[model samples]
Target chain A: MSNALSVKNLNVSYLGNVALTNVSFQVDEGALVGIIGPNGAGKSTLIKAMMGLIPSETGKVEILGKPIRKTRKEIAYVPQRNDIDWDFPIHVIDAVMIGTYPHLGLFKRPKKQEREWAYQCLERVGMQDYGKRQIGELSGGQQQRVFLARALAQNADIFFLDEPFVGVDVSSENTIMQILKELQKEGKTTLVVHHDLSKANVYFDELILLNKELIAKGEVTDVLEVNTIQKAYGNPLAFMKNEIGVKQA
Target chain B: MNFIEAIIHYEFLQKALITSVMVGIICGVIGCFIILRGMALMGDAISHAVLPGVAISYMLGINFFFGAVITGVLTAIGIGFVSQNSRLKNDTAIGILFTFAFAAGIILITFMKSSTDLYHILFGNVLAVRPSDMWVTLVIGILVIAGVYFFYKELLVTSFDPTMASAYGLSTKLVHYLLMTMLTMVTVASLQTVGIVLVVAMLITPAATAYLLTDRLWVMIYLASGFGVVASVIGLYFSFMYNLSSGATIVLVSTLLFITVFLFSPRHGFIRKVIKSRKRASLAN
Candidate 1:
C-alpha cells in the first residue's frame, strides 16, 4: 500500500533558532498517528511544516505519492482552537461552509447542495442545532466541534488536527474521537499533534515521539515504554505514569 | 424654489450629489472589511499617505490617480515589510510609514509650488468637483464593488482564519495584497469627496453603524451602503443650504448616525443591553 504522508529531512527555524531538525517520518494509509513531545518541542511546528503552513528551509512533503499542493482539496487541517479570533462576525453555518470553498474556483459561490452537506457535517459533530449561533457564543468544546465539522465538510483523504483535545469537554472529546475513528474506517489518514501524554497511548494507533528530533516512530504500544517517553520528555515519566495508571485502572 | 428644484436646475449640484453618493457607497462597502479586519488605522494611514502621490502627479502634469495608487500600494508594502521583518507591531509600522509619506507630500507641495490647490485636497470641495473627476470615481467604484462581489468567499475565509485558508491551498499572501490594492483604490477614489483629513471617518462611521445593527456580513454591507448614501445626501443638502463645508458635514452626519446605533441598536447596542439588564433585575425582585 502507498504511504499516505511522507516527510524527508524536514527542517524549520524561527529567527535563527532551530525548531525542527532533520526530521523524517511517514504514515501508511488509514493510520491514526499522534505526534507528542514536551512543550515547545516543535510538535505544532512539525504539523505546520508538513501542511506547508510555514515555510520549511529544507524538506520534502508528499501525500499519497503526489506533491501536497496538487492534492490540496484532498487534505483538511484543523488548527488549535485558540488560533482563531472567535469574536469575528461570522455565523456558525457560514464558518462551516468555508470548508467547501477550496473546491470552488474564483467567482463560484457555494451551491445549495454544498450548504446542505455542511449542515450534515455539523450534524455529525452534533452541532447542527447551533448552526445559527455566533461562533463567539459557543463554548470551547463546541468551537472545537465546529472546527471538526468544517474539516469533515472538506471530505478530504487526509486530516491533520493540531492539539484537538485541549480545553475540550469530556463529551466533546468522545464525539471527536468517535468521528476520527469513523474517518479511519473510511480509509482516511489522520495525524494529530497531541499534548496529553496519558491519553496519547490509548488514543493513537501509531506514535511519533519527538523532542526537536524524531525519537521513535512505531506502534503506540512499543513507543509508550518508560524509557522512550523519558527520552522525549527529558524527565522520568512519573506524572504520565500516574495518569496512565489511573486511566488503566 | 425648493431644494429639489435647485438640484434639478443646477448641473453642478447634480454632479456633486452623484459624486457624494458614489463615494459614500464605495467607502462604506470597503470599510466593512477594513474595520472587521481591525485595519481601521491602516485605512487612516493609507488615506493620508496618498497626499504625496497627488502632489507628485500635479507636479508631473499626469492624472493624480496613477501617482496616488502607486504610492498607496508602496506604503502598504512598506508597512507589511517593516512589521514582518522587525519586532515592531503593525501600529508602529503604520505610523512610521504613513508619516514619512505624508511628510514627503507636504515637502513636495512646498518645493514644487504647484498650481493645484493643496487646501482642496486636504479638505475636499465636493461642489468644485469636475466632470472628469466624477467619471474617474464612477469607474473605480464599479471595479471595486465588482471585485468584492466576485471574490467574496475568498476574502471571507482569508480574513476570518488565514491558517485554514493556507491549509486548504489558498494563497493568503496574494489575498492580503489584493485587499491592500483595493483599499488603495478606494482611498484614492474617495479623496475628491471626503479629503484625507476625514476619509477615515467616511470609511469607518457608516460601516461601524451597520456593524452594530446586523449579525450577517451581507446585511452589514447592505445596511452600511444605505447609511452611507443617506449620510452623504443629507450632508450635501445641509452644506448647500447652510453654505458649510461638504466633507465636514458628511462626516458629521455619519458620526451622528453611528452614535444613534451605538445607543439604540437592538442587538449589540449599549442602551439595549442596559435595558435588558434592568428588566432582569426588576424581575428578580
Candidate 2:
C-alpha cells in the first residue's frame, strides 16, 4: 500500500517556546490512525503544522505524493471545538456549505448540486433535520456531528480531526467513529487527535505516541507497550488500567 | 422650511440627504463584517486616525480622501505590527496609535487656524456638504457595496472561522487586509455625514441591531443596511427640524434602534428571553 501522508523532521515553536521537536511519521493509505499523547504533547500543534495553518520552524508534509498547496482539495481538517465561535450567526447547512469552498474557489456560488450534496452529507451524520437551525442552538454532540457533516461534505481523501470526541456524547462519538471507519473502507486516510486512551486501541488501526517528539509509531500493540507508554506519559499506571480494560474487552 | 421641502428646494440639502443615506448604507454593510470579526475597536481607531490625514490634505489643498485612507491603512498596519511582534494586545495598540494620529491632526489644524473646518470634520455638518463631497461619498458607497457583494463568501468564511478558512488554503491575511482597506474607505466616505467622533457608532450600532435579528450573515447585512438608511433619514429630519449636530443625531438614532432591538427582538432579544422563561415558570406553577 502507498503512503497517503509523509512528514519529515517537523518542528514547531509557539512564541519562542518549543511545542514540537523533530517529529516525523507516515500514514498509510486507507489507514485509521490515532495520535496519542499526554497534556501539552503538541498533538494539536503537529496537525496544525502539517496543514500549514501555523508557521513551522522546519518540516515537509506531503499529501497524496504532492505538497499541501498543490493538493489542498483532497484534504479536510476539523479544528478543535473551542477554536470556533458557536454564536457566529450561521445556519447548520450554511456551515456545511463552507466545505465546498475549497472546490468552489472564487466568484462561483454553490449551485443546486452542491446544496443537495451538502444536505446529503448532513443526512449521513444524522443532522438532516437541523439544516435550518442555528449552529449554536445544538448540544455539544450535535455541534460535533454537524462539524463532521461539514467535513464529509468536503469529500476529501485525507481527514484530520483535532479532539472531535472532546465534550461529545457516547452516541455522537460512536457515530463519528463509524463514519471515520466507513471513510477508511473507501480508501481514505484519517488521523485523529484523541484524548481517551481507553478507546485508543479499539478505535485506531495504528497509533503514533508523542511527547514533544515522536515516541513510537506502529500497530497499536507495538506502540502501547509499557516502556513506550512510560516514555511518552512518564507514568503508565493510568494507561495500564486502560490497557487492562482493553484486554478484558 | 420643512425638511422635505428644504431637500427639494435647496441643492445643498439634497446633497446632504443623499450623502447621509449613502454613508448609512456603506457603514451598515461593512459594519456587519467588522463586528463579526470582533474589529469594532479597529473601526473606532481608523475613524479617529483619519483626522491627521484630513488636516494634512487641507494644508496641501488636496482631497482629504487620499490623506485619510493613507493614515487609516497605516494605523491598521501599525496596530497589526505591534500586536503581532510584542505581547501587547490589539486594543492597546489601537489605543496608542489612534490617539497619536488624532492629536497630531488637532495640532496641524490649530497651526492652520482652521477651527471651523475642525469643528465640521469633528462634529459633521451635513447641511454644509459640498457637491464634490457628495460625489465622493456616492462613488465610495458603490465601491464598498460592490466589494461586499462580490466577496461575500470569502468574507463570510474568514470572519466565521479563520482557522478553517486558512486550512483550506484561503489567505485569511489577504482577506483581512482587503477588509481593512474597505474599512478605511468607508470611514473616509462617512466623514461628511457622521464625522470621525461618531462614525464608529454608525459602523457598529446598526450591524449589532441586525445581528440580534438574524441567524444568517447575508440577512444581517441586508437588515443592517436597512436600519442604517432608516436611522439616517429620520435623524436628518430631526437634525434639520431641531437644529442639532447631524453626526450626533444620526449616531443617537442608530443607538436608539439598537436598544429597541436589544429589548424586543423576537428571537434573541433580552425581553423576549425573559418573557419566555417567565411563561415556562408560570406553566409549571
Candidate 3:
C-alpha cells in the first residue's frame, strides 16, 4: 500500500503510567484507517505520541514520509469530546480557525482569508448557521461536527481524529463518513480511533488493533476477525474501548 | 467639567480614571482566558505571591513594579512548569505558593524600621501613578489583547479540545503558556489600584459574570470590561464615602455580582429552572 504514515518502536507514558510500548503501525496514503482497541489500550496515547503532545520514550513517527515534527503542515487532529471544556467562551468559527494556527506561524494571527476558510469549514460540516454561536450551546453531535470542521479547515494531507462520531445520529455519521471518503480521494489520509464494529465494513478500509502494543494492523477484512477482536479487548470476553475511542456506528 | 478646569481641577480623578480604564481593559483581555480554563483561583494565588516580591524589591531599593513583575512572571512559570511536570493538583500548588509568599511579605513588613509606603503600593494612590507606568500598561494591554485575538483560533481550539488540538500538530502547551504569560502581565498591570489581595477579583469576577451572560468570547470580553468599569466606579464611591478599603470593597462588590448571577442567570442555572420549565411544559401540553 502507498504509505502516508509510519510508526516504529513507539513508547509513551504519562505520570509514570505506561500507556503505549513498542508500538508500530503504518497508514497508506488516501486510506481510511480505523484504530480499534479496548479502554486504556493506548489508542489516544498513540495519537498523542505521534503529535509529540505526550513525550515518547522511544519511537519514530513519520507523516507523509517525513518525521512528524517537521511535517506538521500536512497533518490535523480532532480530539475527544471530554478533552475540551465546553464552558469555554468561543464561537464555532473561532474554534475552527485554530486548525490554521500552525500555518499562521507564531506571533502572527489568523487573517481574513483564514477566517473565511474557517467559515467554509463550518459550512462543510453543516454548521454554517452556528458559526457565530458559542461552542457550549451546541449539542454533543453538533460539537463533534464543529471539531470536524476545524480539521477540515486545517487543509492537511492527513488527519488524526480521537473520536469524531459520539452522540452523532446515523445521518450525521453518514455525512461524516462521506467527507472522510472524499478526503481519501483527494489524497488526504485519515486515522480514527474508532469503536462501533457494526459499521467497520462501511467506514474503514484498514484497522489497527492495539493493546499496549499493536495486536494487529492491516486491511479490516483480514485483521478484524473474532480472535483479533477478542485479543484486542482481552480484559473481558467482550468489552468496548474507553472515552478516548471514537464511537462511530 | 470645563476643558481647562477638567484638566486641572479633576486632574487627580483624571489620572485615576485613566489608570482604572487601562487596568480594566487589561484584566478583561487576560481574564477571558482565566475564566475559560477554570483557573480563576490560580490568578488569585499569583497576585498574592507578588507581595513578597514587592517587599524584597523595596528592601533592595529597586522599583516596586520590577519586583512585582519578576514575581508575577516567576510565579506563573513555576505554576505552569510544576503543574505540567508533576501530579500536584493546581489548587494545592497555588495555595502552597500564595500563603508562603504572603507570609514572607508580612514578616518583612514587620521588621522594617524605615517608613514603608505599603499603602501606596497596595491600595495604590492612583494620583501618584507616573505617566511611564500608565504608558507601560497601555502598551502591554494592546500587545496582549492583540496576541489573544491573533491566536484566537489556536487558543479557542486548544482550550476547547486539547486532544484534537494536539493531534492537529497544534501544541496545547505552547498556547497554554502563552495564555498564562498574558494573564501574569495583566495581573501585574492591574496591581496599580486593585492591590494584590483583590486583583484576582478583577481578573475572575468580570469574566465569570460575563460567562453567565454570554457564551461568545467577543461578547464575554465586552461584558467583562463593562462589569469591571461599573464595579470600579461603584467600589471607588463606596470606598471614598464610607472610608472602606478600596481594594477590599471592589472585591466584595464583584463577589456580590458573581453570586447574583450564579443564582438568577437564566441560561447557566439549569437545576432551578428545570422544575419550573417542567411544570410549564406539562400545563401547556
Top lDDT prediction, candidate number: 2
Order candidates by lDDT, high to low.
2, 1, 3
Interface DockQ of candidate 1: 0.75
Model 2 CAPRI rating: high
Please tell me how candidate 3 rates in CAPRI terms. Answer: medium
Sort every candidate by TM-score, greatest first. 2, 1, 3
Q: After superposition, how far is residue A188 of candidate 3 from its true place, in Å?
A: 1.5
> Candidate 1 chain B: minimum summed lDDT over ten consecutive residues — where?
B111-120
What's the TM-score of chain A alone for every prediction?
Answer: 0.96, 0.96, 0.90
User: How large is the interface RMSD of candidate 3?
Assistant: 2.6
Stretches of candidate 2 exceeding 4 Å from the true structure: A242-249, B279-285
Candidate 1 vs 2: which has more DockQ: 2
- Model 3: TM-score for chain B: 0.82
TM-score of each: 0.95, 0.97, 0.87
Off by over 4 Å in 1: A245-249, B111-116, B275-285
True contacts kept of each: 0.84, 0.75, 0.80
**How would you encode candidate 3's per-residue C-alpha lDDT over B70-136 as one tens digit per residue?**
7766777777777667789878777777777778777776655543456655665544557766776
Q: Lowest summed-lDDT stretch of 10 residues in model 3 chain A? A: A240-249
**Candidate 3: where is the Cα deviation over 4 Å?**
A235-249, B1-10, B114-116, B119-154, B168-174, B256-285
